[model samples]
Target: MNLSLFILLSLFGTILSALIAFISAKGQGHRAVMILLALSTGVGALSSALFLLSGQTQLIVLQSAWLFGTPFVFTTLSALFFFLLNTVACLASVYAIKYVEQYAEIYNVRILDALMAIFVFGMQGVLLSGTPFGFLFFWEVMSLSSFFLVMADKEAASVRSALFYLIMTHLGAGAILAGFMILSGESNFESFTRLAVLAQNLPPATLFGVFLLFLFGFGSKAGLVPFHVWLPEAHPQAPSHISALMSGVMLKMALYGFLVMVFGVLPAAGTTASLIVIALGLLSALYGVIYAVLERDVKRVLAFSSIENMGIIFTMVGVAMFTQAQGLSDFSHVAIGAALLFAVAHAFFKSGLFLGAGVMVHAAHSRSLEVMGGIAKRMPAFSGAMLVLALSAAALPPFSAFMAEWVFIQNIVSNLATMQPLVQGVLVLVLAMMALVGGLALFAMVKFFGIGFLAEPRSEHVAHAHAPELTISLPIYLLAACSVAIGLCAPWILKTMHFAELTNTVQWHTDFALTNTTLNPFALFALLLVVFGLVFIARRASSNIQNERSYHTWDCGQPITSGMEYTATAFSAPIRFFSHMITRTKKQVIATPVLATNKWIASRTFSLGLRQIWYDGLYVPIQNTCLWISTQVRKIQNGVIQFYIALIFIALVVTLTIAL
Candidate 1:
């Protein structure tokens, strides 16, 4: 009934959902379990988060002596992530009722549902926890739960992907633990409040080391570059609905951690730290979009795009840090607000797109883009919803993403006049980098939509595709609709957060709809709505009036075929061609002449795509070094009791000598 009850219900009810899923596996099935999970999350968690975000900040610190004597405390920022996690997870449960049904025969749906429920519970715990001990405890719960989900398919590839994810995540956890230890200092204070107080007195170098540790640790979770290798692999291997949770909701947990450390615990970043964060963010944005443009898998495209969006969020974070350090408190709040807004927008749009991807993959029986086509004509309503999500992903007009980016860009541009020349130059370069990132992001979304959904059916599987059930369909459209609502109501949302002390610029708006406002998103939304309505009516009327079928007269008796449509490889060929040095594209061609006399006639096969540059250049060498070390260590583990005894005796003698 109350916010505290809701939070408690959200936490325990999640565990109840998992228990129900496990116990009633044979009797109730996934639908019932999913509904319980959804109600637990949507009604309780969602309400609490929404109420908190609406400016009713509640403080709940419950004792957890049984675990580690730490308490559960909910901050405004935690409430923000609570809203995001539950919102996406709620919709995902509905979608999962259908999507997981398809995989029921292949994998244990009950186990999957249980794991998913635990996964959500773990994330909720992370958001609710007050200290690093509780945070890492629940963090492992989340990671381990997802690791099992990734390997649910029980295929060799899935297992390998899961192991890779496990290794990377553990390394990240280690880094986070180290950062926490540094912050806590000698007294071993586990509370974040105490840690922050202690951290303020630490030396500059030590604090900066903690900052770097937090970045690497959280960046790994957020799917940033160099630490992003696990994301694409693990997302594709997991069930599609789970992929939505991972990309849309789970990644934001990392953002939550990073924000907690940088804005809450650690002091303001220096120039060097700010520049490093900004550079990494920019590099991640560019690199991710490039791969998104190059990839052919549906989920992989979304995964890479998630990297790009997270990059944008982190860049805003860097901007906030830089502004705070420079004594521009107002602008710092504005930049961080932009980051927060983008995170919210991404939570909806990216989840919607991933669920939409699941629908496509389910209908077509493939994740490969090359095999899917003509979905726009069959599932036109679904396609329309997906178009909204795709546009949001591209940061196009009249979508929440565009508004978020506009604020970030506007903040930078507004300050260019007042800043020093060096600072102005840096901001200018950031703008340019973001512009390029935006363009490539648009290109990637176009390829994702056009090649996968618009053309003639590229394969037999897609040709017979049908629409999904209402359970599967409704949640995605709701998410898509949020993009428009978020865009139109941007000013009000920002104003509310500003009032709650989560954002800035409550003073800029007299009314969002009024003409005097710097940006009237409502006006833009109305304009687009009218244009789209008119076009839709015209198309409907034309279709209704024309009884006779029209044919292409230029066909010359040769019927249209899928062979005429562009392949995924061909569509992205230009990017590979132009960015060869970066992409390191490899090509091979084999040809045979029809006849020796007919030199001009030949049948040829060709292949081209991005080489695994990061894998080969970075990870592979590291893997090799580890393997070499493992071999050297293996020599000491010989199967001889006498040698082992001698080694133990030598170790005991060394211990005694050191004690003396």
Candidate 2:
């Protein structure tokens, strides 16, 4: 079947959907917009991509005119990315049906709906664009749309964030264009297929420069460390469903570009390149999770955690590259396959978690976890959906996150003893870091769920909160359930990807392929079910509602106070103490001594701030340098007539001399 026709139809449908959403009455169009978005972007695009991947119908999708000098193109790989982009977009559209209502009073919800639809279309445009101009054009469409979404609230902070995002994103775009230029050489408009051929003949130094350009270009968008200053600042500024879409679907655009560059457009990069990528990923993962642990803002915490997850996926890709360079296709396939699966898992759970955070923040009217508690008691169903998302983020068993991490670790562990010394040592470090990052992620989520949900109400807002309407909660449950379903379907996914064939001339098993360790999700599910059943039964038997009991929880039975329970800050005290230097945590002293004689004895006060290594150590210095240079340059425009005449005369003489 000719998939191009279907894809074209989907794009047409997306435009129509966006147009309708933009024109509809302010409060009457959100539902229709979402329905149209789900059909066009969600169903239309998804069906076309999946049909192409299924390979049953002859794919006229891949043809000669489809490749060389075309505005758009497709392959099995792009088709896979196309599938992922639409999957999350579909669910997110449905979720936005209710999430945007809170903004309807203060903003034009119809325009917001249209922008979101266009944003998805732009992202799809990035995947489809085969030419450099096409790609950059679509990239800006996506970026500009998101910038407006970030500023939709019209807050000063959000405007600053939007400008910062716009500036940084354009810088990266420039770098990408430069890399494209270098690869295409004399033929600036060469298609990617031709560029791959051209790259094979390039000098080693030139190729290395191209790689650096690409790393910065793509890494900034992917939120890799040292280039990730904008990510946390920008992601939380958007509406929550918009945040979900940005975090879940948009980041993968960078991944797609990076992969195509490394393995597709360019020839084999050496071992050093692979190692550099690995280090970058490791640093980002550690940095992101540490901040996630210490951060108190609900959305900001999720933003940092997104950095961590992105870092982990980058590391897996680096591992794949290293193995591929070393001529070990077995480990390479496993690493790459694991990376893709991990990304899929992250998209589902992170989107759900962001949407869930929106719900909590909407009810409490605050983003601070310090002010949120007892959410579970107030909105049990909402809490339940979020719980699944939290567990998935923590990488617990019988969920997508666990299975993704599991297969990577299992493959490495089972094969570690058989590898060479160098490979073995690197694997050991990677394995250890993954374990540590996983634990920290779990800690972050526990703090996220427990401090934000389970405890007694920390403020008045939470005390009388109610669950949101069905429009909001239903999408969350569905997304959260995917976290479980994807995990259960891991065996089949891996098999379909031919991970079994690539990793096993040794004939690896279905669960823990090519590994001796075999703990399947099915087994884990069985174990957790038994434990859950027993706990439920015990709670049922222990209850005695007939004999009602109540106790004073705060102020010696007088009243409840925010200070009565374990606050999020206090919960993270041990971590702060241990990693204060890394986190830039600080304390202050407040003197209130009894008298002049005892004035030396003073109480200490704390005011924690994150002086992140990247933002301060790198971006700030660059900013100051630029400002200093600008001042120096400004001196030239002194606005004097005599000086201008002399300068013009000198310039005319110099030009005549040069021309002669």
What clash pairs does model 2 have? none
Candidate 1 pairs with clashing backbones? none
Q: What tens-digit string does per-residue lDDT give for candidate 2 at 479-595?
A: 988899988778766665422221112222233362334666777788899999999999878998578578554466466666778887888888878888778854554556656
- How many backbone overlaps does candidate 1 show? 0
Where model 2 places Cα greater than 4 Å from the true spot, the runs are 25-28, 56-71, 497-517, 538-560, 586-607, 641-660
Candidate 1 per-residue lDDT over residues 24-60, each given as its tens digit: 7462567888998898888655665566665654467
Give all candidate RMSDs, comma-separated: 4.4, 4.9
Residue 195 of model 2: what lDDT? 82
